[model samples]
Target chain A: MASLIAWRLVAAPHPASLEDYPRPPAPAALRLTTLGDPRAGALFWMLWLQTFDDQAGVTASFKKMDFAHLTAWLERILALDPGSEYPLLMATRVYGAVLDPGRQRLMIDFVGRAFRDAPERRWQWQALAAVQARHGLGDRQLALTLVEELEQRVPARQLPFWVRGLHVIILREGNEIEAAKRLMELMARDGGLTERQRQAVEMWRERLEELR
Target chain B: MHHSRQHRGQAPSRLSAVAILAVLTLRMALRERLARAMALMIALCWAATWFLASLLVSDETGPQAAMLGFLLRLGSVFLTIVTVTFSLTRDLQNRGLEMMLALPYPRGVIWLGKGVGFSLIASLLAILDVLALLPLAPPGQALLWGVAINAELWLMATLAMLLSLALRQAPLALTMTVALYLLGRSMHSLLLIARQSAEIAAEHWSAVVAQQLLTVISWLLPDLERFTVTDWLLHHGGSLTALAPILTETALYLALLIAVGHLELRRRAF
Candidate 1:
């Protein structure tokens, strides 16, 4: 999972140019267009381009290339598409994976900007909540707001059970254990929790008691 | 003339039987809203793939790969829920068992026929969904082979239906079905947990029993996770070679469940 997260982060369209990197022969004739979906096809190519550039930067950090040249490459890519969702989401996701306090703040800013621009997008709301939870933003106030908004917008019957699970997680993180417990009970009443989920909840309850 | 009329009113001819069964299953499936729900689910999955694809940057190596991974993991779970709730539950509610028994056909034959019919429907849906997802997948033959992986999920649904018939309670049946799904997905993790727990608390019999139970359930239930080829499809561009073995195992499991269901139905007062 950690490696996967790193791959996504490094693959984001950095503002860096690929020319600084030593051009290795393309490994295969495979191109993204053959994969299908023009949108995804474009994204795949962009990811490859960014990955090559990022690797060049790493090499520069190791004194394989001029640091200024690598920096210029990064700046160029960033300049080309500063507002793209791909980089912002990838950066935020990678930031979450690393759990770095400073990087997390940067991720939150990116997600916030994305959300402000596209408030209707569920991904933006979810990403914002995730970052907010990690950063303890507004003491999880942002997380709560996003959850509430999602609940109101998403139909109760059609909502995925994971969303409700997220709400429970938020409540638990906010020191609302009793409320979380009550919510679980309500879900049980509504036949939402499967037998295993209920069992897992029981285990959680026991662990909570030990903590208390 | 009376004797000829009696023969005419008897069981349907083979051609008519096939046509009637096809129409009945399709019409009933549509009327119960299952068809609409499945269509909506497919649409949502396509939308999700598009959204995820759009998030990939030009320089990323694994964004498309990761999105595909996420979709398959999430899609498998959703498919299990939908299959069990919609297909299996509808059969139970509509007295499908009674209808089957009422027919002059052998009980086992009826069970096998219904199972095949439901499996076909599920497979068709799975194939359509995979085609819809093709555009978002990484370039490979493995991506195309991922279509067959959905058969495992359908097998689980068939098993769930048989179990529900045996249990005769929707809530309990649904709970068990979902539990089976979770167990199938997390079997390896649960086994590791059990092994670790056993070493830490060897004296606790309850813990030992829990571990044993989990291990048993993992093996007893269909391991739907084994059919997951999305990782290989998106990353390595390799076909799922385990398709034949998995299909055989699923068929065998379905046979056993249906046999058990047949026995239960045979003994049922109604």
Candidate 2:
């Protein structure tokens, strides 16, 4: 027993990424039937995903994951319980922080697609995805496109005016002076902005006039 | 006239026999160190959940409580199966079971007595689970989860006892009980799948027949889909009124399993 313990302490194992592991295809109906509760099934797989550390350690870093498989799993889990915010949270906050631009875009796109399905419950993730597009990926065009969709698609009353006015700010940053001025005028005319938002809009319109 | 009077006299004797046998079963489980084993399991489960909770990046209370509830439920089911099956198998091996059956008391006295004993053991396991889960979940939700889990474990215990009496071997009874428990837990999903398939392909006879067969199996098996729900402990949304169907199903299944076990015992020649 002493020799075995000494040997175990001396030996080292090879480090492996989470990509080395095989991802199971978890269909929603089968999981719901087998586990009998969607929340329980979703929680089990969510916990299982944390077990794949490259080293013999406590938690796996999202940087080491295969984004394709991770996106597929997040999709399947969201199908099981659409109301669950954990999957979306992981997409935007955890996996979105990876250094790889391609993987970051994949996470952003997954969040975007999920938002389209339940915009009322998930607009914040979409907003974060737009921010990632602009700042992280250095793609202002994609950010402008996403922010425009949010403005047009989501119900106005469900979100605050600041969220709704994000497209104008993006357009202004992109130097679309005429379009930004038009959107702010339309927003002010619509009579939905709060007093503070209206004041900010007026100040921004004056700034845009000088830039033009 | 004499047989009828003897039947009347047997009632009180049978009651006393049941009480005596129940006490004996509890003693046997105590000798098997059930409480110590269950306590160890509860501690291990609590530690594991606490470690998992620490790994979460977001607010961890709800998911942690859900995971703890799930692990405790699984542990209780496994312990109940092992204790009930192995204890009965030991009694059968030592001829104690046959000796009891040879007496004038009806076989049900022996069956109910042992069933009630195992139910007590199940209650003990549930109580340990509740205490372990108390700090993680709300007290009301935790208590409800404990009662629901106790009902689930009691159903499993009665089923395990029936399987042991019928199969007469430790390994066989244990295997059959686990298989049946898995089947019962997943049967609801199978029925739903079959129904969907039938609707999609109404002209296909295979789908229709499969639906019919699963319907029969669902009827014969205990519907365990709602047993020990984690949502109750997580405060997602469940009330005390929701336990009515689970309790009713458990009582019905327990009575049926005990009756069938008694009939099986009567048919044995020993």
Candidate 3:
């Protein structure tokens, strides 16, 4: 199964590029390193995959990685092949971190393509929702719709603390602080507060009180 | 190992650990000039807090701000360095840790007992400092909240000790702890940089690597900034509603640090 996945990743055609994509120039050292390496192709793919893994596990797992290092890895992977599954996943996760609307839109389009190819994957849906929300796309109606669908399909018992927390954020961002507070209180009562979740709830509560 | 179920006399093992910790603290209080140094530093910090508070006047910022500002400026670095250095270098230097390990009690107990003892002493100093700044602080819950924030500082001190044990080098452990402190404080900024860089230079290998490393560092370090409620308490005259969560997370982080320290310490041949 792993081999098949690897093969599919390697054999997959390059993903279509967004027009006027603002690709930052590659670092001189990285470009030089890749140019001389015989196995640069495979190295690039692996680096791309590692970047996605880092993002996936960022909150609770990848605590030792610094921002500069993560960016460098993503850039290196993308430099080798922009269309790889690894870079696509990394772009989706990175969207939440970026503030620029244009950059976020590019990531969203990439995610949209990934979803079209793999419609059944829930993560792609979640990524698209996040990117769309960040970009203020479609009156945010589409993002809300995706979240609503996700909430229904993701059983309360099975949902990760972060995913659940994201729903609370959605509520608060939508000016539903009271509802968000209530939801956070419920989560705390149910012992669902991961360290980060608890901190987020506290921050949200403080904001709500300040507004009040 | 003798297992004494009933104490016909004093429990020597327990008494011994307590005695050791007391002696250690006393010696530290004396040798490192901790007594006189801490006293002077605390007084200076209190004066600074007073000055800052006077400038704010009747503003909500008073007790918590004074306490937290003083601690961050003075207590955190001082207490952390002292605790971590004593826990790591002093023990190995004097071979005191080896003797303690030879005792009947579990090594974990000894490590924790020492941490608790150091934390208690640090907390006492912190309380005194906060009390000194009370005159400049706003009335109401500020003092109470200030004490709570001090407790968080002591908790971090205990955590530093565990890291000292794990790393087994005073300087390196102190460096790492401080680095973690900085990382936790600048988490939002770090995340921003990672995301922005990734988007702008998606094709740049170096940028990608940089972002990945930042993510890892963010996850590994305990976010000390979250416990910094003194500002809110002082400036806004408000208490954190997330006290329960904060306490829970601190406990988990402390436990994990101690557990990892124990594993590392146990593997040493000496």
Winning candidate number (DockQ)? 2
| Best-to-worst ranking by lDDT | 2, 3, 1
Tens digits of lDDT, candidate 3, B1-270: 335535465455775676676567656655766667667776676565555445321344433353445344346456645655665577877898788778777777777667666766666666665565555555444455455556566666766776677677888777877666655655645655577777889648888888888888878765554554444333443455645666676778777766777777777766
Full-model lDDT, candidate 3: 0.57
lDDT of 3 at B126: 60
Whose DockQ is higher: candidate 2's or candidate 3's? 2
TM-scores, in order shown?
A: 0.50, 0.82, 0.48
lDDT of 1 by residue, A67-139 (tens): 3332333223332333335545444444333434444454455555445544454455454556465455444
Q: Kindly report which residue stretches of model 3 are placed more than 4 angstroms away from their true locations once superposed.
A: A1-212, B1-10, B13-32, B49-74, B139-148, B199-209
Please give, for residues B1-270, the per-residue lDDT of candidate 1 as tens digits. Answer: 357558887676545554555456555556767667666666676676566556544434444554554454456545554555555556667876677666665555555555555665666556655665556455454344454456665666676667677666767777777766655655655565676677679648987898888887777866655565443444444555656766777678877877786776677664
lDDT of 2 by residue, B1-270 (tens): 358667865444677878888888887898878879998889888898888777776675777888888788878899999999999988889998888776667777887888888888999899989898888788888888888999999999988998998888999999999988887887767777788888889749999999999899889988787888787766456678989998999889887887888888878777
How many angstroms is residue B19 displaced in model 3 relative to the true structure, after the best TM-score fit?
7.8
Candidate 1 or 3, higher DockQ? Answer: 1
The lDDT per prediction is 0.56, 0.81, 0.57
- Model 1 chain A lowest lDDT segment of ten: A27-36
Docking class of 1: incorrect
Candidate 2's displacement at residue B126, Å, is 1.9
How much is the lDDT of residue A166 in candidate 2?
Answer: 75
Candidate 3 Cα deviation (angstroms), residue B71: 5.5
